[model samples]
Target: MQINRLFEMVYLLLNKKSITARELAERFEVSTRTIYRDLDILSSAGIPIYTSQGKGGGISLMDNFILNKSVFSEEEKNEILYALQSLSIAQSPESEKVLAKLNGFFDHKRSNWIEADLTPWGSGKDSQSSFSKLKEAILNRRVICFEYFNAMGESRGRTVEPLKLTFKVYAWYLQGYCRTRNAYRTFKIARMSDIVLTEEHFEEREIQGGLTMEDDETSLLSLRLNVTADSAFRVFDDFSETDIQRMDDGSFSISVKLPESNWLIGYLLSYGDSMTVMEPKHIRERLREQAEQIAARYQ
Candidate 1:
């Protein structure tokens, strides 16, 4: 925790361009003496920190001076390492480089905290290869071709412009423009049929500040899915939490901005009897036909 606070001080000083010991102590809830002590530590560690006694000057890092990773405490090293390891999987070169730079800061014991190999998704099905190619596409700002299996067990080949990588609800997804559907779409790597990193390039998009998707042609489809209480959480966690409206009898009315594709059909089917199509009579009808066919198979 002390190291974290120290790193916070350095980050703020470098960010603010200038601040007084009084400000640092106040912001960090420490005594002015402690602030001065921190400055001394930075200065000794070659952070180029110094004090000025004149009007409006207190403490500052030199304009060109930089943090030497060698001076980072074990805890600071641990944080940096963890961040870098995550980037490596998300395909962030900057994060991976930070992980490499983190190497300069940590001793052997601290290096253990930066394990990039372990993943929350488990090791079996969607491990290294899936994330590896995704990171590659993101780093290069390129579109990639991948085979995707729709809900009907149909596999389609398509290309997508990888836009941003996201971590939510304990999974990783690539949100991008789906070329075939001509819409913005989010694809989960775990469900990806096969991926082939293409030579085609794409201009990178800015990190959208929040979950709001701009109403655009790429974000075109909207649908209503009627789901029981047990199945609602997955939908809530997938789409905007605000998008879900509750019905009177404890069922759910789920609305989502979906790309135009057969993918929607498969998604609804994944819920099986736990959900039903309410709007877009076409989807509801289609589900009915499929159910009848499946029943006929049993008969």
Candidate 2:
């Protein structure tokens, strides 16, 4: 912005021969030292300014000094205009305020900032209370209270230290410290309800585990399961793309080591009508036992 102000001062001086630093300092509300430095930078870039030594002394540019195509190439000028135009169309709040300036600058160049805007919520829409509230908590470093419905649909109220806002492949998740669970937990934003910012502030904690911004091979849940082809996609949906793999038999299998958890058994049980276990006998037995309990309930 200071560069823009400097250009404006030089442009105004083009209409006249010279202007004193005192006049510039008064108009710009900056010290005369700053004005002198600005003048040095401008003159070094071939603006052709020199000081006069008299009672009515001031700064003057040579009569033949013309601002032609010496500063920037036509391509470079268009490049700058094109970049500013792109920024004017960004998904931020500042784009609309810049439209007027882009319009004026358009006539000064062959490039134009097109029908672009920066409304993050799109046309005739606004951000939801969930986004607004979560953003507020994150900004203020405050704890939040909300009801979390886990993958099992079990609802629980919690006062957690908000750690990070994560955007998983298909959903937004809040990774935080769960005081109840005594561990870090990830809650899907869509499944969260009645999210409120609490007065209690939270200390910053590093998110030690779960998905990261990078697509590293070691960053995904790499589990090997012997499942039917029908359930392969469903299993892959939980893990990221860099980790999913298909075996030669077209079955639900992974390329890396798997975890031994009850959730794994439940995951296999969902496809009761099709899945089978080959190497993991324990998981298969648990799934069979769970299926029998369901059958007993029906009976």
Candidate 3:
């Protein structure tokens, strides 16, 4: 893949000190034009890469430029390698190869200290394919079309310029500019289907804040939840120990801040009777109404 080749090219320039475009092409088994494009990609990403033409001129990084000031330090190098190793769980071939190259460069053997698998439990082949496609679209700045199911169970077609693929909580989200909405929006990858990569390209728009992992202070709701002992495993898994209080009665009480959204409502409802919303009466009432509606449906 071109991404892998681009990474290898950097690694090569680091080790060989310098190399001609033709030599890089031969090494990668690609055309000189393709090699130049790869070099452009590296340069655009702020890698300080440049081409010099003349006697003893070739592709190389800026002299005296280390990968980063801290990158050569053993602890920092291991931290970077560990981060890459975690990212490789997504089955990103480029990241895996880059990790291998970095390991060799640092003369460090790979350690299985950390593992990050973003895919949900029991996720199938389709999930992997969707993730791979989203990654490609985001990288290529390509527009993509897909059918999306929204929170209220409404389905619609969306044409968006894929910008970022985010793995948050237990699901994957795509942050993109939606042509239909004329706004930036986040789409849950699980709710998307028939995803098609369009030939049409979009000018990269500066992404305004849309969906982010950081909780917005203005919209965040401070919550208190009292949970039965039976829900301790779920509570501990989702909340940090600092937010959790073990009650004298062996129950668990958690104080946390969450972004106010319908998803939060559904999440809280998932606990059923095992948990009680101790504060935020509005949220509790909403869940109560929904529970009543669910009971009505069963009746």
User: Which candidate wins on TM-score?
Assistant: 3
Per-prediction TM-score: 0.48, 0.46, 0.63
Question: Who is ahead in TM-score, 1 or 3?
Answer: 3
lDDT of 3 by residue, 64-113 (tens): 86775444678888888988888777678778879888887788998888
Q: Model 1 over residues 1-299: C-alpha lDDT tens digits?
A: 35556767777777776788788888879899988887777778667777788898877778887665567776776776776675564455555544554464454333434334435545664667777777778768878998866434466777888877777666666788777886677766556757888888988776454433322223356788778888766777676778788889888888876765566666678888988777778778877887788789998
Tens-place lDDT per residue, model 2, 169-226, is 6667777777766677777676677788889997787777763221121223344455
| Segments in model 1 whose C-alpha atoms lie over 4 Å from true places | 1-70, 73-75, 87-108, 111-127, 133-220
Local distance difference test, each candidate: 0.70, 0.65, 0.82
Q: Is candidate 1 or candidate 2 better by TM-score?
A: 1
Clashing pairs in 2: none
Ranking by TM-score: 3, 1, 2
Q: Tell me, by lDDT, which candidate is best.
A: 3
